[model samples]
Target: MSVDAERPAPLMHAWRHPAPKGAAGRCIGARTDLPVDRRKAKRLAHRIRAIARREGLPRAVATSPLARCRDVGRWLRRFGFRHVVDAQLAELDFGRWDGRCWEAIDAAEIAAWSADLVGHAPGGGESVRVLLSRVRAVHARAPAALLVTHGGWLSAAVWLALGEAHAPTAATWPKAPGYGRRVILWRLQAPALHRPSDR
Candidate 1:
């Protein structure tokens, strides 16, 4: 599919939330609600402003309900953009292992997660398929919007958008978009309709 320049572009910019204050090397998933690092939040706010200037303001600023994203949403709200919290944008629930350190988790369970990336739920949390469903739903509802969400959520969305043929192995499928990074994914617009005389 090719994009028609004549039509307004439908763009979705997914910005991974910056690392929350002191949330280093921990299993911080949907259940974890860490606050944004104060210094990092300042930097992120500036970048968001730059993005707004370049993109000419998003249709809406959407974020995961988690504090990491919600804090960023708060910053955006203060900046004058309409912010909305969508649970669909929340990170994958890590269940029992939500806030546990990676080293503290069972090695065998981590291996299980790797063996069946899509189906295995780390600490009995949401599966990859479930996360993808929610992410896709959000995209379908708001094709053109700015989203602040988790790395896991963003990775799943990218993998799904790439389609099954380009699907990667369990070891390589979902990849975290580095904190504070901005990724813009676009869908090509359908061809314009032409009148009989024009054709």
Candidate 2:
């Protein structure tokens, strides 16, 4: 067996941030910084804290810098948890398409992105390949960390965990986990092997 296949997978617990206000029907992305309801953020924070207590996980939580995700992390900080805001955890950047209503974008542009899902940068922003790389970096940094982030970010993590051999088509792409929902992930790929001299 290959070294990577024989290595144990890393573990991660991630939750999708609560739905943001004024985001319905809009193409919210890294550029769209909408606020989430404070109460909802608190509720999610409580859930995360309870999970950590039950699971004996660390008291640190990482979140995307977007307000929707950061708000929950703020509440966790109030509860004495160490909250970190990471830009890498942000959602896919949609460039000009971000914060715009979905109907406003050109259909051809969307189609082009769908055709080259991994390489094409939607709205002239980050591509799926880039997002996957960011997720992989985060996993490599803190594989067992608790995270609060966006649907796109979570989806990227899931794709990497599943081996990510080929680019996913629109039909094959994994759906994002529900808002305020938590998903546990295991990193299946092993860390890069280093030469003995390098080590």
Task: Return the top candidate by lDDT.
Answer: 2
Worst 10 residues of 1 by lDDT: 190-199
How big is the positional error of residue 158 in model 2, measured in Å on the Cα after superposition? 0.9
lDDT of 1 by residue, 63-180 (tens): 8898888888788788887889999999889889899999999999989888888777879999887887887788778877888888888777677655555334577775677888
Runs off by more than 4 Å, candidate 1: 1-10, 166-168, 188-199
The Cα error of candidate 1 at residue 147, in Å, is: 0.6
Q: Which stretches of candidate 2 lie over 4 Å from their true place?
A: 1-10, 188-199
Query: What tens digits encode model 2's per-residue C-alpha lDDT throughout 83-110?
Result: 9999999999999999999999999999
Instruction: List the lowest-lDDT window of 10 residues for candidate 2.
Output: 190-199
Global fold similarity of model 1 (TM-score): 0.84
How well does model 1 score by local distance difference test? 0.74
Give the Cα lDDT of each candidate.
0.74, 0.84
